[model samples]
Target chain A: MTLSEKNLKNEIYDFKKFYHLIKAFTISTNISCKAFNLNGEKIASFKGPESDTSFCKLIQKLNQEKNYCMQSYIYGGQQSEKLGEAYIYFCPYGLVNWTVPVIKENKVRCFLTAGPVLMHEVDNLLVENAVKMCPMLDKRRKEIKSKLSKIIVVDTIRVKYLADLLLKLAKIIMAEDAVDLNNKHELNIFNAHLVENINEIKRTYTLQGKNNKISNFQEKEANLITKVTSGDKEGAKKSLNQFLGYIFFYNADNIEIIKCKVIELMIRLLQVVTEVGVDYNVVSGIKYKYLKNLINAGDFNEISKNILEVLDYLIDCLTPLINVKNRNTILIAINYIRNNYHKDINLEEVAAQVGLHPVNLSKMFKKETGKKYTDYLNEVRIEASKNLLLRDDLPLVQVAFSVGFNDQSYFSKIFKKIEGVSPNKWRVLQKEQKNFN
Target chain B: MDREILNELTVALQKGDAIKTQKFVKIALKKGYEPEQILTEGLVSSMNTIAEKFKKKQIFVPDLLLATRAMNAGIFILKPKLKKQLFSPIGKVLIGTIEGDLHDIGKNLVKVFLERAGFEVIDLGNDVPVNYFIEAIKKFKPQILGLSASLTTTMYGMRDVIKALEKEGLRENLLIVVGGVPITESFATGIGADIYDMDGTKVADKAKEKLKCSNF
Candidate 1:
């Protein structure tokens, strides 16, 4: 099914022959001709006024009578007999009929038909018929003669030989068409399969990679900023520091476009890793001090000292509320929650840990995160619970307890309530669905 | 009489006194105190206090870095002799900047405090890709995998390391802790990363508490 360059070329070559044959027939017999392939695309035609649809309709008629009339019609040449079947007509202007069936695997894949030729070569035939049909045709004699002159006699021998050649050529065309189609089909299948896997692999790496790259930049940026701000001096010293800061910060911008490109390379890297994964720590670190300077010069409020700000910005493009004053209470609360999320802890304990009354801390939590204190606590707990669930060796009860719930039953209830499924159910579904390997 | 020496030792450490740091360590060790204890109680404690001051902006990263160097100088002099009985480490940690990323300031700061807080830290340097983390995990076999990413783009490499570790059956043996600018508790949770914190100073204690948990 894979499409190689060779098979494609052969199909094009076959189509060219079809085109030439149609043109040659038009010249030889001076009859308007057309060839429609199986898909109803007009592959060859000598019709100037007639549309592709007209030829397509004729082919359909020929196909319907393929069993009864195909052989007789091709052999009849210019003298083909016509019977009433919704397709046959005896017009003075022209008579139309099939040449031969272009069979593939014994089924017709295409048809060659010549049509709309003058039935009688006499100059007065159209004029006489038009007068019988309509008086206007008497005035249209020159036009009728011109139309009749275009319909010359069909040489029966040449017609039969050309039909035979076309039939054989159509067979070859169908064979090569099948080969090319199979190649295209397979290529499409392969591309879809590979593209799907590549996408999945890329998606997996991009999320994690974004976090790491952003954090690295944040840490490095902070360090350089700290260096510049702490060593602040007037005039030349400030300019030098600002210049260095600009260089460092600008490096982060330069890194933006490379993110997608590096992600592509990492996808390939991930494929290799999964195949024969390694376990080795090789430090190939790049120094980014120059990039930090650019960041320091920018309004510090636009940046966050917390690595997560950079991470959030890079991953989600979050614009955190810029503030001149540091939210120390939030920092303290966050630190306390992070340290004690796994322990048997509560909002009061966290409030106590941050030296705030429970009510005030609750309000502060909501103010900072737009959620109530207990909601934040539960959010943290459920988040941790999900991680523990991945470690299947841990009992569901233990996993629940590990994330701060004292009662396993309560943990399961809340976990299901938040996750919309019990921990065990979540674990089971996850296991059944994803190998995670 | 001993009060004078203790006061001078405290002042020397507080004032970024390198020479006094070595002298205080030598004198403290000579006075029947263990070198490891001197490191834990004197050298590390001073750095911890210095970190707090730095956090308050009273001291800067350079001042903190200088203090840590002073602390390291003392530790270096004491480390070989006290090799058999190193201070009860806060916890054994395998920390690194994830691969394809080279920003190391946050990681370095975390290392300073985590080590100062009596943890044995094996810092796999910046731009450490997933393979490095896996390798470090296998070699050091630390209970915690502390990953740092400075670039939002490269931070996702942590997931690769996480997956690699999981595939290797190493996740169960280790608590995967992540920190960086872009990393979130949600992201850590999303990727099944164990512990996520915003600041390097907090990461050490968070790792400590997590490691202490029998379940972790």
Candidate 2:
């Protein structure tokens, strides 16, 4: 079912609120529960009494299992039959365990189970009753019951909220249809805009070596030109106070380099002014100086204005370039790569398609991401191979080819390089682990 | 053989006319002027004009490249004659595009600028591995090491290369200059780079500043 934008947004909002609830419950009650997949993939879990990586991994394993079964023991004559594909196997003392299925479209997508409760209360009547009943807990029964109760209470709320959030998230994901939405118009516009600005900066730098000598001003002007050109306004102001020093060094032809430098500085200054997005007053002081210099030279006001306008435009162009989100580009590139992994791809072609030079693109891609293009491609291919390897139904050669590897041996070589084992070995390991579990 | 031929040579080099540059260089040589004088006065200045125009935005990369080609032509004619009187090395610099990056345009620009600015730059080409940079550092003992990484991922290679240099105690003695698209002043600071330039032209200026200060 397609989800509208409004529906997806609502779901996300609901899910966020639900997460807060879970966070509060886990903190207050000291109970821990988690949502897992049928194969034991623990999607989300509250912090247990003792955090263990193996326990987490085991939860993931159980979530991955396709079959759903429930079995409970104890409680004497008050026996409870499983209500769903999974159940909440709660002990009387409040410590709870068991996986409850979260179903969507008749498929057991997620499981919510709560356990290890710690009940915080006065340990008088309840503690006495627990000590009398369930003789297995007779030794330190009060301590066990109190801890168990708290753990169960805290954990159950957390799991329930988690399940609620997961259900909301699923609805949102189903609604948003990320793959389709990402390909929509607005994102494309944003990407294009980013590409344009980057291209412009690159083109300008290539065309204009970042140096130009202003060959006109006096020494005072020359020094001012230098400071301004170097993007140091305060220094320019400090040195400008010594007017005689400038006049003594005034050489018209010698200052050509300084003149060119000032114009370039003016351009850079305009870029900064626009990006600041402040009122004209912020730059009005600099603007006045620029105008005064022109006025002193008897240059037309119209000419100065025109030049400033162009400078402003150039500066405006740079903001998008500077602010271009690296993550977005990497995300787009990842999506593109995933779709086209089977195709023969190279940095030059991809860069061209993405509107970057082959070298710059390679550099940017590597810098933004921690992997080279070839390595990233290999990672995706390896991941695909892993999923295929799990299926005993698919032949090794066929699985390799299906995942875009031309030769099974070459695939095995790269797979071993990445996975640190042969594909068959990896498959066997996975199978053995499954059987053991 | 006339002074006019010298002017023609300059013009040809300025316009990046390689054939004309070669012909003019041959004529000037036949006229018995010292090749070294001809090189410094004619070819260098001729290329200087092109570089100036490049700096002024009056010429672009293709124009600069073509002029460089012409400058090379004149060099071909004068090379043998100037062979005995080798150009004194101003300073040794090891330059390369960092590992995982193959963009050499910026690296090449920096090399050319350094050469013109009187530094003897050892071009290490593109996609240079960390070990190679460290090896070059050991072998050349350059005063400055210019590392160019156009990609973000490849820039990490700079850290590794620097670490290797430090491991060998070379980093203490050497000046590290970095430049590229993804590199920023903040990033340079973060990475403990001695100098960082946003572009190739700025790389030359920053290199000069670093060399002068030699604070490291």
A1-437: candidate 2 lDDT, tens digit per residue: 12133422332335454355445544554445554444444456665444223322322344334222221222110111112222333333322344433333333344445443322232333454445444444576545444434322332244445434433433343343322322232222222232233334444445764442123224545565455433343454443322211211222112233344445556455555555453465556556666456434321112323333434443444335433545566677778779877666666667766766777667667977878888898899899888889989999899888877888899999999999999999999999999999
TM-score of chain B of 1: 0.61
> What tens digits encode model 1's per-residue C-alpha lDDT throughout B40-154?
5676567667756754657543344345545655665666556444457656888889765645656766776677556788988876767777777888878777888754445
Off by over 4 Å in 1: A1-437, B1-7, B13-16, B32-41, B44-65, B78-93, B99-122, B138-144, B148-160, B163-172, B178-191, B195-216
**lDDT by residue (tens digit), candidate 2, B14-112:** 775767888999999898987756876787767657656764667543455456656765776675565333278657789998875755656766676
lDDT, model 1, position A65: 41
Alpha-carbon lDDT, every model: 0.53, 0.56
Worst 10 residues of 2 chain A by lDDT: A75-84
lDDT of 1 at B16: 56
Q: Chain B TM-score of all predictions, in order?
A: 0.61, 0.61
